[model samples]
Structure formats: C-alpha cells, structure tokens
Target: MTEKNYLTQKFEADRSRLRGVAYRMLGSLPEAEDAVQEAWLRLSRADTSGVDNLSAWLTTVTSRVCLDMLRSKKSRREDALLEGGPEPSVSGEDAIERETILADSVGLALLVVLQSLNPAERIAFVLHDLFDMPFEQIAPIVDRTPDAARQLASRARRRVRGGDVLDTAQTAQKSVVDAFLLASRTGDMAGLMAVLDPSVTVRVDAFAGGGQSRELQGADTVANFYNGLAQTARTALVDGAIGAVVAPLGKLYVVLDIRIENGKVVEITAVGDPDRLASAEVSVV
Candidate 1:
C-alpha cells in the first residue's frame, strides 16, 4: 500500500481508542468527535516519517485539542457554538441511543466528579490513571514538569478516592445530605428547612441554563430553589461528600455538591458542565 493509504488504514484502526480518550477528556459527544477529527487533520497534514508510534502521536494531538476546547468552553457564548457545525447524518433517536450507551459505559457519576476538577488536573488524572499514560508523557501536554504532572495526577487521585473512607464526620454529613434530598424530593418545606442552616447557600453554575451562574442565600431562598425540584434527584456521593445526582432517563442532568457543617448543610453547588462532570468520581449512596 502507498504511504497515504497506509496512514488512512492505520488511523481507522486507532479511531475507537482515540474516541474513548477524547470522550473521557470531554464528556460531550459532539466535542469529543470534534477533538478526534482535529487529530486526524493534524496527522494528515504533518510529516510522521520519524514518529515511533502513530497511536501515541494521535492521542497526544487529541488530548491537546480537548484541553484547548475545555479551557475555551468557559468563555464561549453558548453551547450552540458546538451545535452550529454540520449536523451528523445519524437520526436523532439513533444519536440519543448512542449517547445513552456511552454515558452508561463511562458512568455518569464518574463524569460528574471529573467535572469538578480543574482542566490540568483532569487531563493529568485521566491520562495517567484511566489511560495508563506516564507522567513523563503527560507533563508536556499539560505544560508542567514530570514531577509537577505527577503531583497533579496524585491530587486528582486523592479527589477521586476522597469519598471512599467516610469517617464519623462524613457519616453525619451523609445523613444531612440524605435528609435534604428526601425533603426536596417529597416537597416537604419544613423538613428541608430543618436540615438547612439559616444561612445556607446555593450556587448554580451557568451550565444549568440560566445564561449565568446563580447564587441563593439564606434557608428560605435556597429551600425555595430546591422545593419541588429534586423529584428525580437521587442520593449520591460526590468527591467523598454527601450529594445528589439528578439523572433523568439515565442521562445525568445535574450534580448537587453539598457541604455540611455542625449538622446542617451550609453550602450546595449545582453543576451541569459536561467537561467538569467528566472528571468527577461519583457513586450511588
């Protein structure tokens, strides 16, 4: 086979693995495809005669594309920026089915926890822990020394494993989270208030669809926001803290990262960002 044909054949062979890496790095399907396509584009245009491993080269390129996309997602005007591209030929239902399978395969709770991490930390952790790449290879991709990259992965590992050993304090916190979720699901205003500090706060990230990040202070305001809302929310552990995951029809909609102090919930952060969610390690309570 000619070099051109040979390259095309090899790329097709590596596509699935590359897509998996991109998807883990970017929780959104469309974004992951875009990252992979960008990698293919680079491979097609660049010289690879001296490259030792085509798969490794492609992974690095895809990772850099994903990292850039993750960093830019915050400043983008809308999710529609991704939607503006040529629509995939697949039918809508087929697309949904594929997404559902992918989400299940990757685990929504894990995605939610990954979303809580910073971009560098998420990349380091995913590459090192999930993909089995070494820190030496990850260091340049994240613009850090090998040791620094190791530190980043180490920190991410701790956060991923943070909720594993729940001590007395965590147990009590879980009770508080359970109470809050039950009350919210049942629409029990009084019960919800009982578990919330008078000075409780709720912060919703912009990805939750208000066009901006929102904050609600005081028990009354926070309780009102959650009232009649968590009907579909289920109890879960988010980064070792008692929290809730709102996954309707098996697709993760939101993650409520809760914090409790002195037996009452003091803070709640609701996140819907896909990339951030991809980094989190969540589990059923």
Candidate 2:
C-alpha cells in the first residue's frame, strides 16, 4: 500500500474519537465536523514521518482547531455584545434536527454548564476531565504551564458542579481560602501566590476602602494587596460560597466575596457598603 493510503486508513480509524473530542469542545455538530475536517486537511499537508503516535497527534491537532474556532466564536460574541443587541436565532426543522443531535450526544444540563465556561477552561475540562487527557497534553494546547492547565481543568470542574458545590469540593475550597488567610495575615507572599490563580483579580468597592473603589489584577498584585492584611478576617460563607469576612466587635465591617476555581482563588470582591453588607447572608465558618 502507498504511504498516503496507509495514512488515510489510519485517520479514518481515529475519526470517531476525533469527532467526539470536537463535539464536546464545541457542543455543536456542524462546528465539530468542521474542526475535524480542518484537522484532516492539516494532517494531509504536514510531515508525519517523525510522529510515533498518529492517534495522539490527530487528537492534538483536532483539539487545537476546535480551540481556535471557540476563540473566534467568543470574539464574535463579544463584538455582538458591544453592538447592543442579541444575535438572531436559528429555527424550524434545521434547528430541531441540530438540537436532537446534540441532546442525543450530551446531557442538556452538562451542555449548558459547558457553554458557560470560557474557551480555554472548556477545552481543558473537556479534554482532561472528559477525555482522560493529561494536563501535560492540555498545557501546550491552552498556552499554560502544566500546573496552570491543571488549575484550568480544576476551575472548570468546579463550575460544572454548579454554585452549591459538593461537600468534598466545598471543603477543598475552604482549605484554599484558609491558607490564603493565613498567608495574608503573616505577610507570606509566596504562600499567597501558591493558592492564588496567576490571573486572579480583586475588586474593592468604595465602601470597602473608605471612599475609593479599585481593582487589582495578576497574582503578584493581588498577593501584594493582601499581604499583611485580613488579621481580623474570619472564614465565612458568602452567599453559600466559601469566603472571608471582617467584623470587628461583632459589627460587620467588610465582607470578602472570594471565588475559587480548581483549588485556587480566581476573583475576590470586597464589599463594605452598609446597604450591600446588610443584604449579604454571611456567617463565620
């Protein structure tokens, strides 16, 4: 058999798995098929002489294609948002057929949650958690370190489980926040960094800062902001989410609305406005 023939046969053999990966990444039959086709086109044009595992290489290529499509879709959605109107919807027989295909392939609830996640998080979570792909494999695809890739999947996992996290996941989140509080109290920069997402963001309301509302981004910046602070902060459940609160002499002074993903702190909102504080249901954990 010719080399081209052999390659074609191998690709055909892996087509099912590739389609599955793309479908999960995109959550749309048409887009997934397009991504798979793109992968095949790229494979036909590239040098596969050094590739030891054709299946793995194909999976990676297909995943990359899906990621690009997802990013482009996200960009367009953002543009639509700025334009101030909702995008038109599809309907009739075509829409029904598409919906039937998707519903048969994936659970509606899971699909809804997956659609809520960002492109990178969706790819990481679907690949690692769903396809059993490793973080080492996912890291390069998402342009992140292995640890960060792991965190990406971790964050996605939490979101998939929804707002009322399972006891185990909630316990895990609490530990991360507790460590963060310890690090903050002791001015431990490295400790804080360890539990914080690389792109963590912190926003403080005017009431929280006595008149100046501000936002901080990046782990280093957030860690710096928290270093040597929160000495009186207590671990609390902010609206059923594990967070921290500062109440001196039994009067609520500030509430830290911490959001954790994949065992790391991703976002923190400090609320100090009396009206805001009055509405939030907070209790020390």
Candidate 3:
C-alpha cells in the first residue's frame, strides 16, 4: 500500500472519535463539523513521513481549532450583548447532548463549570479529568509544563467540587420542570405557584431578541409570565412527558422547561424557538 493509502485508512478509522471529542468540546454540531474539517485540511498539508501517531496529531489539531472557535464565540456573545442583541441560540444535536451531559455527567459538569479558565486550562481539565489523558500528554497539547497542567487540573477540580449545592439543585430543578409544565397546560396557576419558590426566576429566550431582560422574581411574577403566554399563545401538553410547547395563535412560539423544588415551582426556562430548544421530546402540532 502507498503512504497516502495508509494515511487515508487511519483518518477514516479515527473520524468518529475525533468528531465526538470536537462535539463535546464545542457543543455545536455545525461548529464541530467545521473544526474537524479544518483539522483534516491541516493534516493533509502536514509532512506525515515521520509522524508516528496520526491520531494524536489530528486530535491536537482539532482541539486547537475548537479552542479558537470557543474563544471567538465568547467574544461574539460579549459584543452582541453589548449591542443589545440576544445571546446566540445553541444549535445542533451536539449542543443538545452537551447540555444534557453537563446536567447529567458528574465529571463533565465539573469541567464545564470551570470555563472561567483560559482555553489551555479548560482543555487540560477536560483531558485529565474527563478523558483521563496523562498530564505529560496534555502538556504538549497545551504547551504547558506537565506539572503546571497537573496544577491547573487540580485547581479546576477544587473550584467545581467546592459547590455542595449541585445535588439538591439538580433534583429541585427536575421537579420544578415537571410541575410547572403540568400546571401550565391544566391552567392551574395556583398549582404552578405552589411548586414555585416565592423568589423564583423566569426568563424567556425569545428569537426577536431582548424580549425579557429583567429577572421575573417571585411566584407572582412567574405566574404572570405564564398567564401572558396563555393569553397570547395556545399550549398543549406534550404527550408522554411533563413539558409543553407554546405557539402564538397557530405558530410555534416557545418550548418551556418547568422546574419544581420541594413540591413547589422554582424556575421556568423558556426557549422561544424550536431550533434553540435543547430538550427534544416536544409534541409540536
């Protein structure tokens, strides 16, 4: 077999894993795809005659591409907010899985919450903590001392594990989601209010952007948000689940996740566009 054939075979074998890592790191399917494509272009141009580990080289390239994208996206979000524009909607199946994993994976959540670090730190923490890559290997990838990478990972762990409220908060969040949906579809505002904490927060991720900027604190505010929705939109209980999609007249408007805590509603997070909605199990008419 020719050298080109060997490289092609190796790339085909590792494509899925590369895509998975890129997806997890970037959280957007399209972004991940773009990152991987760029990585492939870099690989095609590299002098592979002496390269011993093609997989590692491809992964390193992919990681750098993803890190660049994340940094660019972060800056864009900051600029958009400054200009009074809405935050960019989370797009693609990869993003959906990232949100679900962040909510569900104990280790993944810890790494995600450490986004305050520089890209190097974030990459080190994810590699060491989540993927179990050795500090020595990670050091080359991030161009840091192995000892420094170890320290970064340790600091990230401490920062994430410091919070003891994760367990209770997650449980309360799930309950809140279930109850709020139930009450909204049944027109049981009282029931909805019952699950909500008095100091609840309600925010809508609207498409026209900047729909509701202020935090809707208190049960009354939460109840009123739903009341306005009910008045302007029609809602139907998504069969087989405790969630609803609110459509304006006949158009799909928002997909809502209701959170209940201690049998009381505590939070309502609304995604106004189907494209932006992370939770997929919605019954759309």
Candidate 4:
C-alpha cells in the first residue's frame, strides 16, 4: 500500500482514543468529534515525511483544536450572557448513558470546574493529570515552557481541590439529594422540610458577571423554590433513581444523587447539564 493508504489506516485505528481525549478536554462530545475530524484533515493535508510518531502528532493536533473551541466558547458565553436559572434537560436515561459511554473520561463535577479554566490550563491538566502525559511533551502542546505547564497544572489542581465537595462530604450530599427527590416527587412538603438544613443555600448559575448568580439563602427559600419546581415539572426515574425535567426554565432538567448527613440535607446540587452532571459524578458519588 502507498504511504497515503497506510496513514489513512493508522488514522482510523487511532480516532476513537483521540476523540476520548478531546471530549475530556472540551466536555462536549460533538465538539470532541469535530476536533478529531479536524485533526485527521490536517494530517491528510500536511507533509508527513518527517512525522516520527503518528499517534502523538494526532493527539497534539486534536488538543489544539479543542483548545481553540474552548476559547471560542468562553467568548460566546461572555457575550451572549443570559439569565442562568437551571440547565435545560435534553433527554432521559438513554441519553445520559450514551453521553457517559462516549465521553470516556469526564464526570459531572469535573466538567463544572473545567468551565472555570482557560484553554491552556484545561489542556495541561487533562494531559498531565488525566492521560498521564509527561510535562516535557505537554509543554509543546500548550505552547508553554515546561515550568509554565507545571504551574498551570498546579493551579488547576488547586482549583479542583478547593471546589471538591466530594471526598468526606459526599455521603451528606447524597442523602440530601435522595430525600429531596422523594419529597419533591411525592409532593411531601413536610418530608422535604424535615430533610433540609436551616442554613441551606441555593445558588443557580445566572451567568451573571459578578455576585452570586441566583442565591437563595435559608432553608425556607430553598425549600420553597424546589417545592415550586416539583409541583410544575414531570418526574421520572433515570438509572434506577428519581429525576425531574422542567420545561420553560433554563435548568429544565435536574438529577439528584442525595448525600445524607447526621440526617439532614446540607447540600442539594442541581445536576442538569450533561457535562456538569458527568463531572459531579467524579467528585461526588
């Protein structure tokens, strides 16, 4: 076979792995697929005589594409700023299962924290921490000095560590999610109130420039907001647990995996966005 045919075969063989890397970096399957495709096209058009490692070369190309998309998305989110309430629901169990399988490395909480990072930091962290790539190689992909890449990884690590509500706190959060779901689905306001902590705070992502996006302080307010939501939306079970999808709201769908503490709901997070939900699963339960 010709060099071109050999390269084509190699590309096909490596596409799936490359796409997984891209998805973890970007937190969007469609974007990841696009990035991999773009990388393949670039490979096809470039002179390959000097290319020593095809897999590494493709990974570099895909990483750069995903970084570009991340930057573009950040710009768009900043420009089109909307009143973020809750994430909209796309589908049910089958949809989530498909997304989880294709993503390969993403989890709900990780995806949320990823949104806070710049493209370079995100790429560096994913490469060094997730894929176990050496800093020597990651440096060039992110166009930074090896020391700088290390710092980027350090900063990303700090952010993740700080935002982690998992670890020892997961059981508490899971209990809250379970009780909240049971109460909401059954219209048991008393049961819901019984589980909520008096100091509970609900903050919706309003996409606002500064300040708490949508903050509801005190258990009463948080309870009331959820009670209202439960009354309006249709509830169903996904992956053997209760979930709800509400239309006409930005956070149209939310899934809760409760964390129980000394018997009260200390934290109740909204799991609606596919990426966020995926990441949350990693950090939480």
Candidate 5:
C-alpha cells in the first residue's frame, strides 16, 4: 500500500463517496461504475498541480462526465427517432449486488424522483442538496448560470417534496414488472412482447447461464427467451422498486432489475449468483 502513488491512494480513499455520487446520478449500477472509472482515467491523464480542492475538483469532473454521458444518451434517442428504431439497450450484469448495496442508503425515494428529472436538474439537485455542493461549481458542469442552476434545483426540489413524481415512477415501474412476470409465468409470448420494447435487452450473469452469450436483444428474441420462464420467480421489491426475485424454498437465488421507459421494458438485468441473490433483501410491495 505504501508503494502506491499518492494520487492513486487518495483516489482510492474517496472512491466510496465518488461512487455514491455516480450511482445517484445514474440509477443503474453498471453505468455508475463506468462514470467513476471514466473520472479516474481523466484524473490520471490530466495535470492537477493547480488543483486546490481535490474533492471539489473530482466532483466537478465526475459530474461533467455523467453530464456528457446523459447528453449522449439523449442524442442517441433523437438519432433513433430519425432512424426509426429505438436506441439500443445498454445492459450489463456485473457487480450490481455491490453497486446497489448503497442504493437504499442513498434514498431510493430520491433515486426514483431523480429518474424523472432532466439531466441538468438531477445533477444540480444531487450536488447541491445531497452532497452540499455549492451551485457555483455545478453551474459550469450543467452549462447554466449559478442562479439558473439553483432554480433548476429549486424546481426539482418542489417536485421531489411533492412526492407526485415518485408515486408516478414507482407505480409505472411496478406495473411493468408485474406485467413481465405474469407473461413469463403464463408462457404468453405475445403478452411478454406487449410490454417489451422492440429494442429490449436481457442480460444474465455468465455464471448463471453456463457461458451462454449472456445478452439477448430485440423484443422477439427476449420474449421467446422468457416465454416459458420460471414459475418460481415472484414480484418482489428490489432496491426499493417493484421488481422480481427467483428463489426456491424461501431462499433468494435470482434477482431481476428492469429499466422501463414510456411504460415498456427496455433493459433487464438478471443476477443469479446465489450468494449475491441471498444477500439482497427481497420484499413484497
């Protein structure tokens, strides 16, 4: 440990907090890890001699990195509109059990609420309210004036405080999850197709699938994959959202997390490591 570079060691120390910020910004564990890794890469390649507040600098950089990713996602959706195909689902099933260990700790309510906000509002509110970051540093990352950033946070704050957005997102999430599970249990391929987007993606753990491709895309492909799925899996509250769990004899062995957009399932993450699944607190809503 002593032989490690001081910069590297310092980063390791802040890794937990940095990851928390990223996770809240992007609800998906895989995406949050990606953002944190991108931030570390940026720090290693840039000159930081002039940096005084290292923590603040890292926060700003990570926020910018997440902002760019979010904008890229929006751009892809627009391009997809013109191309006449929905955007490809970005799905990965790795380290989710670890990444989401803090999901509830970070306030699942806020995560659901933040999901409804535009990118800028999400960043502004997360940095200012959650992390106590001043709007001055946040403004540049969002490309808005400090006051404007504050106003964005204010608007987001109102919505969050009102709880209307949270209810809506949670309700929508639960409905989709229920529909998917019902279709799977009943082996209704067409029913499964109804709730899945054309570009739907299914990702399962490599260990679970015995070296299979681990990723299946397209509504038809994924729907077929689950047409006669397990009857054991039942609706459960996953990380404070309505998802599903597969277990036998009262021991959780599989967990599914879905990304629903416009009332359709676009991405699905399935984790089946017995240890990780058992570690998850599966509850009924």
Candidate 6:
C-alpha cells in the first residue's frame, strides 16, 4: 500500500477506540464524533514518520479536543444539551433484564460526578482509570507533570469510591434508601407511600425534560410515578448521601439523589446529564 493509504488504514483502525475515549470525556455522542473527526484532521495534516505509537498519539489528540470542548462547555452545554427520549416502559422480567445490561456499563451517578470535574481532572481520570493510560503520557495532555497527573487521578478515584453512606453508622439514611429501592424494584405503591413524605418532591435535571417531569411534586404524585417503575434501582451512596443508583449492569444510568427527613423521603433529584453523572460516586450495594 502507498504511504497515504497506509496512514488512512491505520487511522480507521483506531477511530472507534478514539471515539470511545471522547465519549467518556464529553458524554455527548455528537461531540465525541466531532472530537474523533478533529483527530483525523490533525493526523491527516501532521507528520508521523517518527511516531512510535499511533494509538497513543490519537488518544492524546482526541483528549485534547475533548478538553477544549469541555472547557468551553459552560456556554455550549445549555445550547446543545439533550436527554434520552421518553423513558420506555418495561415490565416484570423486561425491566430486570434491561437494568442488568445497563448496569454492565458505566453507572449514571458516576458520569454525573465526572461532569463536575474540571477538564484536567476528567481527562486524567478517564485516561488513567478507564482507558488504562499511564500518567507519564497523560501529563502533557493536561499540562501537568506525571506526578500531578497521578494526583489528579487519585483525587478522582477517591471521589468515585463510596463515601459517608458507606458507613454503617448512617443507618437512618440507609434505611430510607433501602426502602426506596425495595419499593421501586417491587413495584409496590404502598411501600412508596410508606417511605415518602406527604409533601415529597421529585425533580430531574433539565436534560431529563425542560418541561413537566422537570418538577414532580406531592408524595402521591411522585410515588405514583416512581412506584413499580425503577425495577433496576438499588440502594447506594450518592455524593456521600444515601440514595439509589439505577445501574443494572453496573454502569450508571441515573442518579437519584434523595433527601430524607423524619425517616421519610422528602426530596429526590434525578440527574441524567452524562457530564454531571460522571462525577457522582455511587456505592455498591
């Protein structure tokens, strides 16, 4: 094959992997594709005669693109934001199976936390923890030393690990989360009513829907909606508090950040934004 053809073939092989990295970094499918295409553009224009590892180079370039995109997200996120279509209804065994598959991927709560991170921390964590890249190589992408990169990953790791809710001492909070999960998984309306306060409120992030479900209120209103619908949810610590994480296959799909008072759930905030979900730390049940 000619030199140009050889380069094209090599880049195509790495495109999917590069796209995965960008998706994890940006949390948006369209943006991830953009980043990957940008990497292709850079590769097309640059000289790689001395490059030892094409995969590594592509990852760095894609990461840089995502970092720039993330840095500029404040203005872009509002305009480009989108969420899943209306949540599909599943019953009995179907819900269980769907949850299991989704859990196998990244948990939604974790994504929320990842989104909360600065560009450097996000890239450092995604490369080192998710993609298994070495800090030595990750350092340059974030303009940090290898040691600094390692520290960034460490901080991100610590946050990913469960927090105070992991403590057995927080029994009351745990009980609330447990009740919520049991009710959700069992589709028990009575159980939901028993645990939720009369004035309970449920609010999902804007990406969930800029309208109606944006804010669902009243214990009956919220419980009626959630009852028998969260078959995949499990008790977990979300951001140091007791709550539920919907991850059937171990990947985060949604984070139910709950607030309980007097042994009853008073508030539940569901965050579905991928960038925000990356930052949430959900404890294993």
TM-score to native of every candidate shown: 0.62, 0.51, 0.53, 0.59, 0.51, 0.65
Give the alpha carbon lDDT tens digit for every residue of 91-146 in model 3: 67756655445323332223234333556666777678777778988887777899
On residues 141-247, what C-alpha lDDT tens digit does candidate 5 reach at each position? Answer: 99999999999999888755552333677877888888888899899988899999999998999755765538999999999999878665666666566677664
Between the candidate structures 1 and 4, which one is better when assessed by TM-score? 1
lDDT for each residue of candidate 6 in 6-100, tens digit (9 for 90 to 100): 87788778876776687678765556666777776777778999999988898999898899999888312222312321112345786555444
Candidate 3: residue 80 Cα off by (Å): 30
TM-score winner among the candidates?
6
Clashing pairs in 5: none
Task: Count clashing residue pairs per candidate.
Answer: 13, 1, 11, 24, 0, 31
Ranking according to TM-score, highest score first: 6, 1, 4, 3, 5, 2
lDDT of each: 0.78, 0.77, 0.58, 0.62, 0.73, 0.73
Worst 10 residues of 3 by lDDT: 76-85
Q: Judged by lDDT relative to the true structure, which candidate is superior, 4 or 6?
A: 6
- The residue-by-residue lDDT of candidate 2 on 247-273, one tens digit each, is 542246788888999889999999999
Give lDDT: candidate 5, residue 141.
Answer: 90
Candidate 1 residue spans exceeding 4 A from truth: 74-91, 167-235, 238-241, 248-285
Candidate 6 global CA lDDT score: 0.73
Candidate 1 root-mean-square deviation in Å: 8.1
Per-residue lDDT over 1-285 for candidate 4, one digit per residue giving the tens place of the 0 to 100 score: 976678778887887788778877877655666677677667777898898998988888888888888877831122221232112222567545556665323544455455557789989988889888888999988889999999999888766545333444544444555567667767677877898888876545432213344666677777777773553233322232333333212122344433345777655444455564434312212
